[model samples]
Every structure is written in C-alpha cells, then in structure tokens.
Target: MTTTHQERPLAVLVGVQLPGVDDVEHAADLAELGRLVQTLGFDVIATVSQRRGALAAAAVLGEGKLKELAELTGGSGVVPSGAPERKNKARARRAAESGEDDEDDALGGDDDEGDADGAGSRGARRATVVAVDHDISPSQARNLERATGAQVLDRAGVIIEIFHRHARSREAKLEVEIARLNYVAPRLRETGGGGDRQRGGIGGKGAGESALELDRRKIRDRIAELKQELAAIQREQSTRRALRQGQRRVALVGYTNAGKSSLMRALTGSEVLVADKLFATLDTTVRALHPEVRPRILISDTVGFIKKLPHDLVASFRSTLDEALEASLLLYVADASDPTFRDQLGVTRSVLSEIGASEVPSRLLLNKVDRLSEDERDALRLEFPEATLLSAKIPADVAALRESLIAHFEASMVEAELLLPYAKQSLIGEIYENARVLSEEYGDDGGRLAVRAHPAALDRLRSLLAR
Candidate 1:
C-alpha cells in the first residue's frame, strides 16, 4: 500500500503574514490551508511563509520567500517577462537530460538538490501545486504560477474546489457549480491558440469572440442556468421547510471538521457522513431527534464555516444555510480539544451574522471534550460557563444534550386544555401527535386532554378540533 507522490499530487503551501495579524492566527490559517489542500487530495510536502506589511502585488510573496518556495517545487522562482520560447527550450532540455517527459517535469529547474527542507532528494518527485493561503488576484496567481512553474490555487479556489467535489444533493451541486464558475470566470486565461477569434456576424465577416471571451461567456451562461435550477430546488426546499414549520428544529452550525456531523449522528441516530477532512459535509441533512420524544424535535446539520469563507460560496449555499436562519435554535458546536477553537467559534458567529441569523437564539456547544485533559476541561468550563461541554462519542453526554434540547423547546411551550366531542373523537390522535399529553380522560361525551406545545401547534390543534 505504498503511495507515491504521483498518486497524490504534491503541494507547497504559501502564506503572507500581514501586519495586525497575530502570529499564532497566521500559523493556524496556513495549517488550515494545508488541510484544505489535503482535502483536495494533495499531499502537502512543505510550507512557505513570511511576515510582510502586505502581500506582494505580483506574487503574494516576497522575492526571497518566493525563491525558497520554488526550491520545493524545483521552479526558477522568477516570472517570465519575455522570450518565453527560450525558457521553454531550456526547460525542455532539462527534462530530456533527466529522462522525464511529463509536463510536470518540464517545469523543473536545472537544480536537482530537491526540496528546500530535504524532504525530496535528487531525481525525486517535486511539488506540482502551490496553494496560497489567501484570496490572490488573477494576475497574482498567474505570476506565482510562472515563478513556481506549478499550478497555483488561492484560498477561495481551494475551498470552492472542495465544495465542488463534496456536493451531493441536487441543490448543493447546482450551488457549487455556480460558485465554481464564478471563481473560474475571473481566472480564465488564454491558452495556446486561444488568440484566434470565432467568425460571426452576417456572411461571417467579423471576428466575434476570442477563445477566452467565449469561455467566459459560456461560464456566465452556465452560471445563470445553474442559478435558475438552484432557485427551483430552493422553492422545493422551501415547501419542505414550510411543512416542518410546526416542528422544533435545531441546526448544528460550526467550523469545518468541528464534530458537528458527529453530534448530528449522535443526537438523531442517523447515518450522517462524518469525516475528518475539511468541507466533508456540504449537503444539509435533516432527521428527527432519536428516542422519539413527544412533540418530536428535528435536527439539521449545515455546511460548516471557515475563516475567509468565499463570498460566492456563502451566497451559493444561502439556501442550505437558511436551515440555521430558520431554525428554532442553533447549536454552535466547536471542538473543545482544538487549541484554536475560540477563533473557530468566532468565524462561525461572523458567518451567521452575515446571513442575519445573529438574532436567532443559540447555545454554545463545547464538543469533543473527551480528548481534553481534566484540567483543560476545567479551564474551559471556567471560561465558557454557559456552554455545554460534552463529547458526541459519549452516550451520557449525548443524552444530556438531548435533554437540553428538549428543555430549550419546552421553555417556550404553552400549556393548553382541549375538549373533543364524541363526533370529533378521531381528532384525539392528532392532538397526541402534535402536543405533549400530560393527562387524558375519556368522558361519556368524548375525551379531554391537557397538553403543552408551541403556540402555533396549539392553534393548529384548536383549528382541527373546531373543524
């Protein structure tokens, strides 16, 4: 089961630590970026980072750091300005001398010293992708690609690609497609022979569009079509949501890989896809809370959030995230074992605020506490006294969380008494279904019920009784 570099594309992570950014935060961002790259199936061999007042306009990294980054990828570390043919010839000669014919090998430099950190040796595989931990401009990406002689992807690009791969539902697929197209639209570059224009107009007399323009147009058209399809799917989703208006819903929202899905499965007893990779769960999954209490509660797991989550993805996944916006309560789950859990929690809150879910009632859930030491758990309790600190893997912890959920909804419930006539005895079953029946008595006339439930549910029960 030996895996070669070719089996998993090698990647070198690059990050620029801008002013006003904490050192630890910047390091965490790069680490998270590495995870994101890994989620895209790339093997991260090395990381390159530098503290700068701002990212370099041309390549997002300084000359020295860029060169250091290039060493890992066997690149020249200089963007070509002109005479591309000469550089291509030199690269080709190097490939021929090395007995390599792959396009990746063609990008290697004359230096065979291998990776900067000695991870790779002479004639060993080099990184073929450079993943930058920021949203770089199109020109910046182009310059970086030329300097490193490897494919470059910025933070947004990486996240979009993960979503594009993980999307499962029809709505999620449509949303990811739209976001991917939007991201690709700006970075579309003219390939070889792309300068030629397509003929159009009467008698084909005029040049209509270049290849790049045609590709951009096609992307734009596809995005529009995807949007229409997404809207249709959203309408259907709305209908489903409307049907559940009377049911209490709790949405699990948190940072990616934060054990939200684990908690989801624990609470709902549903077989949700839980993975350690970032963005592993893109589609929203809903199921009834298990153990089936009266006035059943429904739990939904949403797509996770991350620092600098792309705007296009936020917009695209709005319908899916609306599960949180429309939920009766939100469980803000965080991996308490993670040292950066506080910062991750902030990211989750910021994204929820962006979507107007800030006003929703939420409870902080410090999950994965099983991995925390006793002292660490005590410290967390002192820091977040209001949060429920528990692990999704523990049955007792899950039962406590379930009870907490039930209590949260119960606090808002209204107690009501309903009387059913003999002629409407069939409605008694509906009453028991929609409300928590504290007492029921069968009288000669029919039945009398004492129940507690949401006001809306009570109203519906009354209307059914009246009918």
Candidate 2:
C-alpha cells in the first residue's frame, strides 16, 4: 500500500489587545495560541500582535496590520511561480485587504520568505496559515483570508481543530463532530460562479438553493444525527452511573494540562494518559481511589477547560461534564507554577456554574507545587490559605489528598445498628453493597449489624428493613 505523509504548515500567530485588556494576559493568550497551533502539528513562524481601541468591522485587524500579514503570506508583492494566476491576483489582494483567503495551504508550496522576522525577507518561506488568537466573525475571517492570501483560523476554529484531533472515544468523537459541524455550518461559503444554480420556474418551489446551502443543510442533518447518537450514549452513561449511585464520587476538574491526570494516577494507581499537551485527555476516565475504602470512592478525570472555549464545544460536552454534577466533591486542580492559574481557576468556575455544578462542594488543589519555588509556594499559601497545595507526582501529597477525600466522605456518613431478620436476609446483601459494615452478629432468627454510610444509604436500607 502506498503511504501519504502530511507536512507541517508554517503559521503566523495573531492577537489583538482591546481597550481595558491587560498586556500580560493578551501576551499569554497569544503564547497559548502558539501552543495550540503546535498541538495541531503546525510550526509557528511568527506572531502578529496589536493594541486597538476597537476591532475593525470588516477585518479584525487594522489596515497597516493587514498589510503586514499580507507581506508575510504573499511574499515581496510578487506572486511566486505556481502561485495563483495574474487574473486572480486582484481578488487575492482584496481578500487579503479584508483579512480573508480563498482556501487553506495546509500542505502548500515552498516559501520565498523564510526570514526569522516573517518580513518576507529574501529566500524566506511565506507563512502558510494565519492563526488568530481571538474569535473573529465569519465575515472578518473571510476578509482576513482574502487580504493575507492564506488560511485564516480564529481562536475558536483552532480550538475546535485541536478537539477534533484529540477526541478518541465514540462519545468524544461524536461530541467533537457535532461541535465542529455547528461551527462550520455557518462559515460555509460558495466559491466561484457555481453558486448561481437554479431549478424550476417557480418563485419558491424550485430547488434554487446553491451548493453552499445544500452543504449547510447536510451539515445540519449530520449534526442532528450526531446529537441523537450522543443522546443514546449519554443514556448508557447514565445507566452506568446509576449502578454506582451509592458510592461517593470525586471529580478532578481544572484547566488544561493542570496535572489532573497525574493526580488521578497518583491517587487511583490507574495509568491515565498524561501528557504536557493541552487537552491530551479528551475522554473521561474513571477509576477507584487507591487505599480503597468501603463503598469504594470513584474518581473521574474529565476534559479540562480553557480560556474562550467554543460555546458549541461546551454545549456538546455537557453530558460528559455532568460527571461534575454527579460528583459529591470536585477537586479544582491548578498548576501552581503558572502565574495565570488564578484566571484558569476562574474559567473552570464559570464553566462549572454554566453546567449547574456550582452547588457541588469543591476544594481548590494548587498542584505541581514541586515546580514552584519556596517563595512562590509561600505566596500562594498566603494568597489562598484554605487551598490545598501539593504535587501529584509525590506519593505523600497524593496520600494526603486521598485522605482529605476520605475525610469528606466520612464526615457525611451516619452510624446505625440494625437487627436484620432472617426472613429479610436479602436486604443484608444490599447493606453490604452500599455501606461500611463495621460489625456483624449472628443469632437464631436474624443477624445484627453496625454500619456507617451516607444518610441516604441508611434511609434506603431502613426502608427495606421496615418493609
């Protein structure tokens, strides 16, 4: 069989700082965008950033910035050999001026602008893609693409692309596709004159829709089908969750690449996929917490949150994030070494609230403490005295976190002694299954047992006892 190799495209990262935005945060966003592009197998060639009072309506960037972007892509105002024809140059220039391009160059030709500064210097390869660090309207995206003569991917587009690549499980794949279709359906455009197709001679009775409209309709149909499939998957998930209803559940939640999977492995001894890449773990993994207590504690690590996560993605993952809703406790893990961890925490909180998990009891986990200096650790401790500071890689820290989880569960448990009858012996199995049976006694007609379990479990057992 013949094999095909994909080439990594060179990308130019772009960001704009609006009025009242902090310079540091904007820069961090751009840096994160670069990382995102790298995750998608792109080589970041340069970054374009600007500060503006307001974004331009047509192109997200100003006129001067658009020219800079065009120079990076078009190369010294001269079309390279094998580039688009002279007749199309005006259209490309107009698109570039408006910050749009005709099609992507994911594996396009060699560049003549490989200069380090991306200034289209001699012999330098032109950037193949422009990755914008902020969400741009569809019109603006088109305009930027036209002006730059390169593919223009705004922040949401980049994120959705990453999700598409990272999704592995069936549910995850379905969710990603649904989100992607929703995002792309509106951005679909008809290229050239083929969009002028018509049908029967009636005003509205004809199939007068263009190929673009047909494509959008197909996308809509596919999204609906995916949603139905996802709903069925979610129902199966709900059934599985129902099976573990009585057990205490703790969900590990936080920003992307925040050591959650590491902590899950440390606490549960399960080989959860751990990588430095953002969104490395898209599928939720559930495992039993180690040093397993009676009525085992189940820990789940979910897809992490990020700044400006696409709304469609969040809506699509609502079923997955429902784990947080079912959780008895939520461990909000964060990278202690990251200066922007606070903002990351805020993003997680906002998402949780949106998903109706705000009422769930949660604890802040300032993880990766090993990466922080003594002063930084102390400063964090002072800043949030109630937050738990620990490194997931350390056994002791994991043990401490485990114990804290156990304590929380134990505190919610109620103690009770019940004299179970032999005739009702079947109830004994349920009590054993749902509670911590501390003591048992056997008598002629029955057995007496002392158990500690959540009040709900006790009430459930008591109902069976009375019946």
Best by lDDT: 1
Go through the candidates in order and give each one's C-alpha lDDT: 0.84, 0.82
TM-score of model 1 relative to the true fold? 0.87
TM-score versus the correct structure, for each prediction:
0.87, 0.86
Per-residue lDDT of 245 in model 2: 75
8-93, model 2: which lDDT tens digit per residue? 77888877776577867877787899899999888887766666544556676655566666777873332333433223455457
CA lDDT for candidate 2? 0.82
Runs in model 1 lying further than 4 Å from the true structure: 1-6, 82-115, 201-207, 419-430, 439-448, 463-467
Off by over 4 Å in 2: 1-7, 75-123, 198-206, 419-429, 463-467
What are the per-model numbers of colliding residue pairs?
A: 0, 23
Residue 442 deviation, candidate 1, in Å? 6.8
Q: Which consecutive 10 residues in model 1 have the weakest lDDT in total?
A: 103-112
Please give, for residues 1-467, the per-residue lDDT of candidate 1 as tens digits: 99765478789888776658887887788889989999999988777776554566677775666777788887898866741212245544765786753222211232223335454642478899999998988988988888888999999999999998998888889998898988889888889996788787763424767878877777887888988888988999999998777778899999999999999999998999989889889999999999998898999999999999999999999999999999999999999988999999999999999999999999999999999899999999899999999999999999999988988889999998998888997887777777999998888877888899999889888887888
